[model samples]
Target: MSSAWGNQVERWRAGINAWVTSETDTTATIRVEAVWQSVAWGYNVSNGVSAFCDCDGSDTPYVGTGGVYASKGETRTISMYTRDFTVPKTGNDRDVRCGAGVRLAGGYHDGTSRAYCSVRISHRTWYQPRRPASFAAKRSSDTSQSLTWAGDYTGLDGGYPWSGVYVDRGRDGATPSNLATLGWAATNYSDNSTEAGHRYDYRLYSYGPGGTSQATDTLTLYTTPIACALLEAYKPTATTVGLRATGAPAYVDSWEFQASTDGGATWADAAFDEDWVCADPPKGTVRFRVRALKSSGGSSPVTLHGAWAESNDVATLCAPLAPNVSAPGVVATGTAVTVTWQDNHPDGTAQSAAQVEVTAANGTVTTADVKGAATSWTRAASQQASAGTIRFRVRTKGDHADWGEWSSYAVVRVAVAPRAAITSPAASQVLDALPLAVAWEVTDATGVSQQSLSIADASGAVVWSATPGKGVRSLSVGTEAGFTNKSSYTLTYSMRAGSGLTLTKTVAFSTDWAQPVTPTVTPTVGDGYTLEILIEAAQTEPAAVSFDVVRVNPDGSKTTLVSGLKGGQTAYDSLPPLNVAYSYEIHAYAASGAVLNYVMPYLLDSDGHEVLSFGSAAQEHLALRYDAQGSESGKASGETFHFALGTGQDPLPAFYADGDIDVTGSHSYVIADADEYRAARRKLRAHADGWFRDAWGNVAVVAYSYQISYDAKQYMQWQLQLDVTETMWEEPNRG
Candidate 1:
């Protein structure tokens, strides 16, 4: 069996078949089968069968350990021991080709022999698709998560065709399971089954026909909670604003809000209160936005803002302006009062109701309401009590807001009362005439409805009564019997007000109807134009009486000649003006200084004269002149007419025959004193050539003469004689 100089040389052929069974990224496994065919059997020793491969395109020893030996023509086939060989990089083909052959070394050797059979068996290696990298996830919706990764890497799948990708999902750190399979073209996936406000884990694998690859790193993400949308913003009160929103997922624990006053140009954080209310906002238009929050202080992103809502005018929610009372400050007891207020609602809201509260000094309280835009309320007269201070306040309500604050209190004083009093004819007064002047005064603030006057005797018997007109403060009422002389009487005045209040007053008075008796008065001129006045025969009625004499001067001024003089003791002397006529007033008074009677007398001065003339001779005679009368009471005497001069002169009987002396003149006078008598005599001498007219037939006065006579008790008297002639025949007309 040995050849080669000292070795055995045997002819043998080995058939071998080799194929790959498994492979990895670094190594490959192969299986081989061979049979030994001995050409000649000689010196058969232990020659074994082995395999060889061109792992790197070169003939090299096959990596194997065991070998087999067989007899010539035995026809034995032994399986090669399992062996692994390192594989090289397979580029885009994902395949490594190797040249392989089997040999029976140590027992047979033939370099050029065609062995029994040499076969080429193909070996295939395992291939895997690329695994994705850079995995990421984000919220796609309120209930879903979105996933993404880089494209599949080349040179790693061993030239395998990509089929699809596998997406796995898990919740709260749990192990992930296959959630979906997507084609290789899909770079993103949506986890639609995710719940709102939940944490999820996600991974992805790029797979081909080879198999699925390793998963991406587990990703943890949270689905967005339902978004909070702002519904409205409005003022709930004057100082507070409210924000209303809708939408909240099960995981949402709270809400956040922001407000803007400049139409969303800027925003301020608003306090998150229950019902989304904010306090003490600016008084004007405002805008609001809201978002949901989690218990961990995580909230929706600021970029995801809700709709802005505009608030109502802040004034609209304010209480109505303070009310005002328009009632009078001072009122009568039963006067009605009306209260009013202004509807100063900033939004001009319609008035819906009003309330009024009233407190009286007597501790009485009253409240009332008016509905339907009524701003005023009236308290009836029946509700007003007399003699107290009344305080009242009011409040108003609008249709859109709550009732306003109460107004400041208004005070009213009710103190007026009906009053009646006798003004004239005072207490213990004495009246002197019938229809005694009885005057009274009455007053009532509410207004007088009725008034009356009455007079009664001392026994309270009503004797006279009269109804007085409205606004009549005084009335005169008394009959002759009611006002009896020296009688005591009572006067009563009664008044009633519109509110049924009445009052009466009584006064006591007496009547003194009897007056002092009238007195006789005589006045005479004394020496030097002095006046003398005497009063007598007076006052038989009144037990006590006095007389007063007043000299009325020409200038209308009075000089008291005598005041408070007894009836028989009234004699007065006064110097009189020479030519001015004056008068005197005499009054009779009772004991109480009341004027019982008065008289005014006109007195003549010395210059006062009468004219008597005969023919063309006219003379201004003294006041002693009068018509001739046969019966003289010693006041005046007669005057005769002569055709010639006085006794010292010669009578002209031949010139003035009996028929020539047809008329005679006679005149008389009483001189108050010697000065008067002298004055009269001087006047007669001044007109000594006077001719006078007589009451008899035609008489002519050629000369006149006067004589004075003095009386012991009466004034002096004077007589004058004149001769006068009648031009007309008055005797025939008289007959």
Candidate 2:
């Protein structure tokens, strides 16, 4: 078990960390982790999780309950106590500790998960029993008296029953006797040493290993001269019940009557006579008793001796009231309806059968017998009232022989079947959230009791539902969050009229949210240098979305190149150059400012060719941004830039084609800079800036355009002289 289940065993070890006080002293609460192995679980089977304690450790278990197993991965902490662990016949104080004990946690294979550990009771804790009850001594014979009693409780012993009862007794005028011990099961004992005229009392106690409990009721027992009593009561008149008693010691004369109206706690002397008349007998059940009283008329110390006989029980027999039929308050005909009513009796305590009498619109009365006191009854579809007025009344038969009177008639009206329509979310309606409202024209003399509106998915699963209140023609659903967009739903509104007929109308719709088309940013012009950022989509349904255009500059700052265009507008020359490789971003946002989609517009560059563009670092444009501080008049823009090749081949002294073919300057055009003019010039290949005309002999200007700003912002200052070609050298007066 250790090698195969090392991780699980370690987890169990960590969970069953140490013994805890169950927050209580006597019982030990062992904490065990809820993890278990499921290898023994059969195919498509799961195991129940529980913890058991084998106090005897003999493969026998005790009772326990564990937490619910939601799934395999989740677990809960289980605290097993001595009660959850102990087996029968195990001594709690001694057997709570483990030598032959084990804790079994069953969330594994066939519930065989187990951990062996010792549980020691720190010290002998005491469990005291409650005070004993019903300690009484009754006369058994002329020479003996018997005692009977009950002790307080058990269940703390863990595995064994509480045993041994302590009894103490004393004579009426003497000191108490020594304590007498009786076995746990012995509830009665006979003291055979009692004399006929003496009185004695007994006190009871329960003793355990801890200590004896406090005294229970100490009742006095005696043998009176009159050993037997018989009391007879009879109703003499409508309101009078007289009681008579016969007792032993027959020679006593002049009997005085004593009566106890309250079941013989205290007696009233002659306040009630054998034939006293009462205006009203008590309504419910009452108890009465009669005590035999005797008095001597002689003057030699008159005495009265009397004793009470066991009481008699009686009740006034009255029939139950009518049963109220409470449901289908607005019944709809032509359908089966279950009639329900509140229990006329408390908690369904009706003692007799009930009957429901139904009078149909045709004046035909039918009485239905209800077997027991079920308050509600169902009328089959065949029994539903077809037209006119039908009424119902109910009666109940109680514990007595006779049945009660019928209840007052509950008038029910029957009318035509209900008609309804789903007015809102009309047919084929497309909406983000499915809001439903239903209208009904159910013209019943009696109004509708319940009406509901629900939206069901295409699979007929109810997605939303609601019950409308009274006088409401329309009911709506769909105020909850998180709606499924790309699906169809059926909105059904149903109204049940007064005659139990339900009318329904359904409307089917689709909530398919067509995603916005991906707009393109393209280079529109046929130049190799510039790109046009355009945004558009192929929309089937017209949507309102504001366009946002952003240009990412070289240093990772964003410029709002263009924005707030609903559609169909263009900004010319707003884009930067192609060689700078800027990234243009376009987004379509709804009125809520929630972005619908990012627009990666097609890049249509100057060459009339679609090009893939990139940001500044890699310079993969086919697009660019010319937004940095510099002379902005296309100052650095040119057809081709030139730099000298190989020191210009000794400066081409005579300019012969064959003499310095290698000295011809190399030409390329890619000087896109973000710096000022002078700093920008330092970045170019080493060369002189004065330009000669091309071989075509057109005098091209290489003049500089200047830019100045207060701090860093630069604007163009354009100036050029197209006639100049090169520096003139002074020819020693030969010009």
Candidate 3:
């Protein structure tokens, strides 16, 4: 039992014997007998059956019901019927081989794993006798004809001797009636019964043991004189032509000879005799043809009648019409231009094509082709000779001869839109005058129907606006109250033409009003009770001031004697008059950093008085820029001062450093309003924000650190630097 064969499956082939019982075009019914010889013990039952190409149209599956048993040495048969089988029949389509198959229809559980045997009905088939090839009839004379053919006659049905060869005759156009029967061995026949002007058709067939073959190839013939036509056509001149042919002109009772101009589009006819000639032809290439007419009331000419002969084609030429042309008044770049024309040459000729002549403003003349005889043409603006004043002219040429005269130039200017530029007040300019004058220029425009310039203030109010007249090339605007010091303004300029042309531009500019200048300081050190320092105001009134008079003891620690005082000539009478190496600093600030800060004053009194010469600790500097836009005074347990900036700054790509190329920046200035703050912001915005932008603008966070103290002396003092870190950059009024 351990041997491999013990577990192996012995599959058996279920035997099927099938044959077709009845068949329709699409379906067939088959009778089947399924018998199983028990190759394995007790494996002999099949219930139902199905088969292919038999009666049933589908393939057979296992049958589980009907039982067939063939006990050792005895045979049992199970008969089953299947219907709806596809017969696949058409013409000679035959189920001649082992075509029908059967199988158990369903749910059969016999030990047999395969079909044991399959039997298909078989039979021998035979073919018909071979028919002769090329069996044809030809005229032997004006009144007689002969028929001939060739093929193997003794090779059909395993060499079945022929019984006889049958021949038939009929008027060429009528049904053939049976004629005499010839000896089985003959393949040719002669007849003296054909007419001179008649046609004839012939066919040959053969038969043997097998059914007759589909009729043999057929042959057709004509015994008429005109069927042997020989026609020819010739042109003697551009307007004259002649035709000639030979056959039995005597039998060609009537003939048709046609002439074509324009490659057969139309035809002109004449009697097809020897003297045929066509007079004065119209416009086109000439081609000719002739056909032999059939005898009036008799029969068809022939099976394959004579056709038109080989001939030459002639083109009738004439003068072409000079094109009458016109063009549009306006043209644009990359747009199509339409030019129309009419061709009218008295000699009857077509307009071959229109020649376009173009002239540019620079006097460059160029030409183009508008091909075809159409009444109109379209050319893209891109295909125009030039983008300038492109003038056009037209002419035409035909197959006949000459190119017609070019028409007068139809002028059209290539349209281009106006280009705008700010000739004055360059971008981001800081003007000092209250009424900023903005000037702009427009070139390449035909005219300006409406041109206006407007400037908007911090609150977005249009403080100034004006419209320029037509034909205006440039405009300058200086409006009252149009500009505000320490504030930024947006200027927009736009223009419109009657031809629907448009151009627009916008730019930013601001003005600086309070420019701090250095005050004239005259310091006279005096021994009196008050230090007389004569301080004259700078170009503008100095905003605030502070000074320091220090005494350095032997160590580096210094002592303050007279400090934190207001600007003017501060006569500090509270001086300790420290005689120990004393030094001092005088400082001042402009109201805001939008403009320059005034210089510090020197101490002076009575007349040129000095104390140990003079030692200065530091120079004058301006206060940092700060704005009170969203700032308010509030009360907490005591009091609180809260301020905000921007709505907060929008993110920027990068921050700009002090002197970058196209990025212009002014480092020395006071910052007050949004205008001044924005100017300074632009200087560093490109560089600072990129590091990490917080709610407060990086520029504001760094610039507004120079805080002011109200103490008299410190009020005038300016803190030049404030240490900053990433965390300190928060919204200005963040709780």
Candidate 4:
């Protein structure tokens, strides 16, 4: 049995308890006990012994001493007599206790061995139970009352359910106590019940294995409402009485009307009405205010006041009367009078029914209703039968009460007849020619009715007269034929009054007349080819004078050449022997007027030219004073001529013997021949000294002439010389 035990022991570790027993030595029973420490695991033991041995049936090994031996000890090594064993555990419990009070029974025999063993063992458990962590709560917003909680038991592998968060209302006390059983979701709490003027309190809680925590410091909160709107005012009338407030919501219940007369200082309550009647008031100037009463009992004052206005009760008066006499008086001749007044009113309709009154002199009173549309009045002519001073007064009717006082009196006078007098050509003696104008002045007690005036010449012939209508009278007059020359004349005037009266006046005047004298001329010769004469006549009757040209030679031969001459002046021409001496004469006839006669003669050379000729000549039977100067003489010889440039005598020679000698200068000389001198004189009949030019330049000749020579040769030579010297030298200095 021990041998068989040894073979089974080879399959396990040596330190393990192994046992074997033999019932017949061919079959065996083996037993072993293994032990390990509390912290070790995975034990195994094995023995190197084969259960199939070669001996069979007849072979028997020797048994050990003492029937069966066993050995057990701690081993550092495993041997063939011991076996190793295994247990399925890991980590710190891998070691196993073996053979400490352990018991085993097993056997292996070759027909004779047995073995038994005992072991004791113990092991420690390697796990502990987990505990929960501290409780914590997470709060989102205090005002929102939202919170969450987390701990060690949360999301555990194998533990109890997690705790929930809790919140308290604090001073607000609005938290729901039932909320502890339910988790604190954000929507779970509602504390928003406090008013806008106040504040509230709040707290947060977390529940774990322990009870709920205390509430946090009180957190307070508050709320408020929304905003309001505006209002306006208006005025509709000119009187400023009907003022209104508007611009309000439709639900407004009532309105309050207030007024301010003195620029909004003290306001008076006008009215409070739901119908808005206070908006439309009476007349006058005023300011207004209003308040709106809303249906919700809310009231707002007027934000604006309407503009000011006026009323329609005041009236205006008429303007003062302009200063003038409208109606002087109502009276006949030598009678008493009455008067009226006038003015302009501003209001045309209000003055339509106005009235006026008047008072006269002698304390007498008279009243006349204003007739038609006229504003002035006057007494009737029958009422003013006697002439004198009169007074007046005025007033208006209807709503106007004032009456105008009495006015100052006006004075006037009357007479029986108008006064008459002459108004033109005054009352005195004075000379007047034909066509004399006559006039008169006529004024009367009534007025001038018929005014008349007349004029007559010295022969008592009525020349002109006039009877004018109402004012002055005038007419023109003329002298009568056969009246004496230079005699006095008379004019008379008359006037009749309008109220049946008469007056007459007369005045005298004188006039004169003198006739004009007739004139005659003489013939003369000059340096030109022919001899001619010009005669000018002065006559009161110029139509009556007659003129003729008669040629009288130096031999006393006479011939009547030109006749039937008319006009105030006449000229005659005749042929004379050229460059030879000749004498000529001119005769004039007045027929019915006074006559004047002048005779002149001249000397001509062989060229049929006069030797001497006067510039201008007038014959006088009497001697006259002479004033002379500057190279002037009365004689001429050969080529040298004596004459004056400016009243001075000197001899000047001719440039040529003869051929139309041109003379021009300022000089005065006389011709000895009466007829020739007079003919030369007539050339300047009306004009005084002036400029004369003849194809040369200009010469000045004085107006008067005297005659001295009659022989044609001597006169011709003298004229030629005079023309060359005086007329030539005195010519204008034309450089």
Over 4 Å off in model 2, which ranges? 1-312, 316-320, 336-354, 360-387, 423-484, 494-504, 517-735
Candidates in order, TM-scores: namely: 0.30, 0.30, 0.25, 0.22
| RMSD values, in order shown | 48.9, 40.6, 28.8, 41.2
Question: Hey, what RMSD does candidate 4 come out at?
Answer: 41.2
Distance from true position, residue 322, model 4, in Å? 11
lDDT of 2 at 446: 51
For candidate 1, give the lDDT.
0.58
* Model 3 lDDT tens row, 225-255: 4443655556654346666555633344445
Worst 10 residues of 1 by lDDT: 1-10
What lDDT would each prediction earn against the true structure? 0.58, 0.48, 0.48, 0.37
- Measured by TM-score, how close is model 3 to the native structure? 0.25
| Candidate 2 accuracy as TM-score | 0.30
Rank list by TM-score: 1, 2, 3, 4
Best by lDDT: 1
Global local distance difference test of model 4: 0.37
Score candidate 3 by lDDT.
0.48
Tens digit of per-residue lDDT, candidate 2, span 12-59: 321222243352443444432222332222222223434443333445
